[model samples]
Target: MMGVKQFPEFRSERLLDYLSTAVMVLDDHFRLMYLNPAGEVLLATSASHARGKAIRELIINADMLTEHLSAAMENGYVINQRNCRLELPDLHSLIVNCTHTPITLPGQRNGTMLELRKVEHHLRIAQEEQLITQQEATHALLRGLAHEIKNPLGGLRGAAQLLEQEIADAALKEYTRIIIGEADRLQNLMDRMLGPNDIPNMRGTNIHTILERVRELVRVEADSGLRIHQDYDPSLPELHADPDMLVQAILNIVRNAAQALEGEGEIVLRTRVQRQFNIGNRLHRLVACIQVIDNGPGIDEQLREKIFFPMITTRSDGTGLGLSIAQSLISRHQGLIECSSKPGETVFTILMPLDSKNES
Candidate 1:
């Protein structure tokens, strides 16, 4: 039997960079010595800034985690904790599976290797898969229904035109015109229900350009009492997408936020780059996260889940196709749209994969 070959020190470090789990090495004093890329994401800090920082400084309210690390290092024992909760400096919390193993090197002091796997990440992947399947099924059913409704609508409009020509009385012709008008309206509605038909005109595009277009249009249409703000990450790379489609998708969400605010509250458009994100079953190394946040009465819990379905609306005049169409457009670009609402805050997040080569 062949023995496994040991990787060189640099090669091992390179291998750690590709791991999905967050890995960190700490000295006996619990000061950060090494941090992988995944670790940087989890801690929300860069390796250069985090190196030599105490573990306590990086993770606020980490007494429990610190205790575990201390015991592992002192006793020279490996410890595994499931669903360990850690508080971050930004006040965000994470539920992760933590593994602490003590290690010794020839010329270096004793250290502990800490591995963190986010528990919620697994759950999110499962939920995303379910959401994608549900959306596909819903879209398929709507397309079938629209096709059936459109055929009869075309015949009804044609008959109305023919009847109008045969009628002599102007009063009776008025009724035919009304019928024709309504038939045409219904035909347009059916087309909207069917969603976009053309393939996206994909090209290298900047997300900020699309967002600015949406902001300008929304600002013009919104009431004077409503305020729109932008918090953008200028470091984001150009996204490969259809600019027009992205504009339409983002516009729909922003408009909905403005409406949710009843044209009297605040709306913020924020952008960031999320690393190692999963959309449905595929994982991308980088993703563009765009958020439309509103301070409003918020969506009712019962309607939140069905908000993306056709004809489901909270407003009396709403066609409810805005969000559905928006979702479809983002989906066409291998992205996802998610919503979360509370009494005072509502957020619509659009996640678009940025690394096409890493998608799998």
Candidate 2:
């Protein structure tokens, strides 16, 4: 304990001034007693602004942090939680891991040491970079496969056409023509599979309009027996995305839900506005959430989580590209797609930042 760092005087205070993890110490009662300099940095508040104030004063939900620490305080205050993101005052987001230890000062009845360490913003940045690399590799492999399959099909289609020309039997000619047509169809499918020019130049547009359009299209194309519900948030803002790509993304998820329903179940398209969502270190201005929920038998246990992966589908006659493409498009927009399913409930949640304002 001799080498351990205890609360020092002037020098310690000076050191706290230069620290950057937004470290804070709470008392046994879960009140904020002290905040170090580094803790101030991540939290965007200085010790003077927060010290001696209840943690709830600066955090919108004081209970969120206190609730976690309460058990530790009661039973010796030893907890280890890491990289947790909490919504702070004024919609600021902070990522911190905390440990609490009961600190009995000279036989004090109740006292504790709460240590919070902030994860560097770069940690999340690194993860995003890794995901982008994976995305690039996926596209490269898809392109290579498309070329491999299309090259041989061209010759097959040519051969069928030549045989058709030489065949004197009407039935044989018709068969050859069918072969060419099918080959061409496959070739076109390959082009789409390769996904050329799928995401166009992005522009700012109202998301409500796109959602309405998608709703109208779903109504027209979906089975008459199936009912589609729409709940739009009037306060939701515009999104910076290619209208075509987003439409395709939403349509794909919704269509999949509808198909899962088989036209008799209910499909709900709900939208809302959210703030202080930290995908990593960035606090979004607003996130436009489009959720596609269906009342069906729910996704299979083996496939529910894996359904977004390429070529993973429960239905026959599906290329298994729709959901994959939808996810890819949404990822490109710096958004995320999450799916969860249980008996009689399946929800696909799409979280896209409105207008790509990710700063702070």
Top candidate on TM-score is: 1
- Which digits, one per residue and each the tens of the lDDT, describe model 2 over residues 57-94? 77776676677777776787478877777778879777
Deviation from native of the Cα of residue 277 in model 1, angstroms = 2.5
C-alpha TM-score for every candidate: 0.87, 0.67
Instruction: Point out where model 2 deviates above 4 Å.
Output: 1-96, 100-138, 196-199, 276-286, 355-360
Q: Which candidate has the highest lDDT of all?
A: 1
TM-score of 2: 0.67
lDDT of each: 0.90, 0.74
In model 1, where is the ten-residue run with the lowest total lDDT?
Answer: 1-10
In candidate 1, which residue pairs clash?
none
* Candidate 1 lDDT by residue in tens digits, 63-160: 88778888998899999989988999899999999999998744767888999999999999999888889999999999999999999889999999
Worst 10 contiguous positions by lDDT, candidate 2: 1-10
